[model samples]
Structure formats: structure tokens, C-alpha cells
Target: MSYPTIPAYQTQANGAEKLSREHPVLDFLIDHQEAFDTGKMKTEPYTVFHVDDFVFTKSDGTVLPPGEASWKGLLEGYAPFNKHYHEGRYACIYERNGIWEMVGFANVYANLLVPGEKTKKDQSGRQWDVLVPGAFLFTCVKDPTGPKGFKVKSMTLFGDGVPVVGEMMKRGMVKAEDLVK
Candidate 1:
């Protein structure tokens, strides 16, 4: 789908303009601007996708199915030390006040060693494990949220596990504070 023509100032080196953190999906939703402004647009809820479900193709165009190890390897490659569990969810993308907004959710689990503790050992010096749960809002510029978008516009962590309305009081990884609205 074609996105709204980005302003000249927003263009980057690669020419694709950067998405605004304050209104992440505004440009993408330009096609439905009228419906959004009039509150006539409908939102799709409970859309789900997984990172591991991607299918890869060879240079000659042979399709490869998704594999467990490939998915784990992707997470390992990106996070290295941390073991990651990602559950991609779509909260909704709706128009309000002449702007598009992405209200997506995700449950991410990262197995990390406790700070200042060595080898996952507890106070008793025995083996201990810790899984850091993080709740994140996954926003993008794609019309249909899927694996097609190679570049991620924004990822803001709100809290641990699934998020609730007005629960921004708790701190996690705060990327864009304005996005909580």
C-alpha cells in the first residue's frame, strides 16, 4: 500500500522518510484520513504474528519453511546474551483527530542473569534463573501489519507482561513517552 507523501525534511539517506514517534502510523494511514477524522474507520483487534513464522527464500527463489532453530538463532543473533521469547500482537490502528495511531501489544521474555550476580547463582549460591518479562507496543508504517516490513519504525516498552490502560505509571523501556496516549 502506498503511504502518504512524506515531507522533504523527514527523508533519510535511503530516501524512505522516518516515521514520527508522536504519531507513528499517521503517514501510513493517509489513505483513510477522511474516515479516521470522521471516526468512521473500523479497527481490527487480536491480530497476531510471530517472528519465527517467517519463510526464507534462496537466491534462486526456493522457499524455506520456518524452523525452530532458525527462529532461536535469529533471537540469539539479535540479543546474543539474552534468550528471547516474542509474542507479536496487534492492539489496533485507529484514526482520531485527523491522525493515525498504532495500538499494538507484545509479550517479550528475556532470560537474563541478575545484575552483580555471577552464573545465575542465588544468595544461597545455588543455581537460580530469571526471566525478565517486558510489555511492548509494536508500531509500524505498514497498512497491514505483517512480516513484510523489514524496518521497524518504533518499539516502546511500557511494562512487564500485557499492558493495561493508564498503566504508564510503571517504568520499563521508555522510548517515546508521547506514544502512550
Candidate 2:
């Protein structure tokens, strides 16, 4: 899977550098930095509302209602983080066949945090405070560089049972139609 590496804004010693306005998704995150910092961002879970005729298939090929599917077994017994579950929107911009393409995703994350232990080193040896995703909803081009662009991929609704893709769309967290364009 070829995921596009979006560039991060470089910061100088004096202060944070100005971010490029070319990326809307990145711009959105920057604009809401305060909301993120203050821990006020809220995104509804996918299961709270009903969808007409929606079915999801697990990795093992079992089909079930979108609301009933579970990724609990994969989380190592860590519960979902409801208060800070939604991690906002992101975009991966890349080129294929000399054509510019963008893939967007709404990240709904589930984590487990120990009261006393606040951080752990990830596989890359970097310490992170947030629990690794017990479950997540990834939208638009799963793994990227495939024919599955502009669709919901693998996801787990552990925290609020909200489907990140659909719920984000409803709340304007992401523009579903713009993802594939």
C-alpha cells in the first residue's frame, strides 16, 4: 500500500512557521488546534443513528450489521476512548500515472490508557501517550493506490459505535463527495 506522505509544517526556534494553505484537510486541523488542545472536539459514534440496509464484512468474511461488528478482540482488551476518540480529518495527496490524486480519511481512534502510566514506546521506539488504535475507521483508498478509493474501509466502533465516515459526513467533519475528487 502506497500512502502519500503529507509534509508537516517546519517550525523555527522563534515560533511556528506559517503553514501552506494548499491542503484543506491540514488547514482544518491547524484552524482547530485550540479545540484539539483544549479537549473540546466531539464526534458522534456511527451506531447511535440507524442506516438503511448497511452491511459490513469482517476480515474473516463474516457479514453483519454495521452496528454489530466488533474489533474488540484485536485491541488487546483496551477500551475505546470516547472523550477523545475522533482524531479529526486527514488527506493523503499523491500522484499516480502522472496524475495528482488525493485520498481523505476521517480518523476515529480507540485507545486504552493506564491511570499511572501515561506513555509507551511504539514499534518505532517513539514514546506516545495515546493508546494504539484498538479500532479505527479509515476512509478513502484503503492502503491507497488501489481501485477502492472514496469508500469506507476497515473500521471498529468501540468507543461510541459511531461510524467515523458517516458520522463525520453528517457533522461536516469531512466532505464525503470531495474525497475522491
Candidate 3:
């Protein structure tokens, strides 16, 4: 299904571009994200800015190990989905004790066009859009030796998985029986 083009977001109080200029780290992060999304970079964003001991905590409190396996797992799980439209709703950057942290939420919708081999028959080849709001918290610090003068220590993602699964089942993207043991 073809989705409408997502318009550029602009904050009325303070433009996001202006803030990015004021915070070079934020600018670098944003630029890197765009480049990665456009296939300009094969490297993941986490490895570029995250420290050696970096961790990713899911909404369920599961802390994935810091390594290539964890990164690959995350990528493979979302390989079937693609973002159809997205718009930033809110974002803020703050500093405390020398750590610069960013918190943001975006309105996102995705399409499950490609189903993996393990996907249920009923869930395959569906042409429907699913609302998938994204919220993230990235904690980092200035690292003179790191890329772009900053390194992330951890990243926490917030989401309600139950509802997403429920929605998928309701829309036939996921079979209810497949979720049962």
C-alpha cells in the first residue's frame, strides 16, 4: 500500500534544526540516523556512538547483551517491517553530571510486506499499516576519543508490546493460535 508523504516537522517554540546546531552531538546523531536509513552507511548507529560497555534495555526490563549478536537479533526481528510514515512528536536534550541525554517520541506507522519463513501463513503478505509509536532514551557522554566527540552508555526503548501484538492479530497479520504454545 502506498502511504502519504510525511511532512517535515518544525517546532513552533524552538526549531529542531536550531537546537541541533546548538548541540553538535545531536546534530551528528541525527545525520548518522538519516544516513543509515538511506543505506549510505552499513554500520549501525549504536556502534558509532555507544561505548564498549553500552547496553540496550527494552521496555520489558530485558537488558540485551552488548555485542554483534544482540544487534543482529534486533535487526533480524524487524527485517519484515518497514516504516511507511513517521513524524517526530516531541524531543528534548538535557545534561547532568557531564552526561548528555536525549528523550524523544515519534508517531510512526509500519507495513509488514515481507514475512519471514517462520511467520504464520495467515500473517504473510499482508498489505496493512500498523501504528507503531516510538519512544527512546539515549544516555551518552563526551568522549574525546570517540566518534563525533560523544559516546552512548545505554539506550532504553519504551513501548507496549502486548497492544502491538494484539493489533496485529486483530488485523490478521498475526495468527492468534501462533502465539499459543
User: Which structure among the candidates has the greatest TM-score?
Assistant: 3
lDDT of 1 by residue, 1-181 (tens): 9986533212111122222333344333232222322333322211222232433323233334554443333233224233333333334555444433354433333334222222343222343223233333333334245333322233334443223111222332223565575
Candidate 2, 125: how far from true, in Å?
17
> What TM-score does each of the candidates earn?
0.27, 0.28, 0.64
Q: Rate the local accuracy (lDDT) of all candidates.
A: 0.33, 0.35, 0.58
Cα lDDT tens digits, model 2, 68-168, are 34322322222333333333334454434433333333333332332223354433344333532322222222223222222223333333233434433
Alpha carbon lDDT at 22, candidate 2? 63
**Which lDDT tens digits does candidate 3 get at residues 1-181?**
9985433322212332222334665665566445544544345555665576777777777788885554554455445465333344566777777777777665444556543222221122333455566777878788886667887677777766565576567657779888895
Model 2's TM-score against the true structure: 0.28
Tell me which residue pairs clash in candidate 2: 45-162, 46-161, 46-162, 46-163
Root-mean-square deviation of each candidate, in angstroms? 17.8, 15.1, 10.7
Q: How far is 43's C-alpha from truth in model 3 (Å)?
A: 4.7
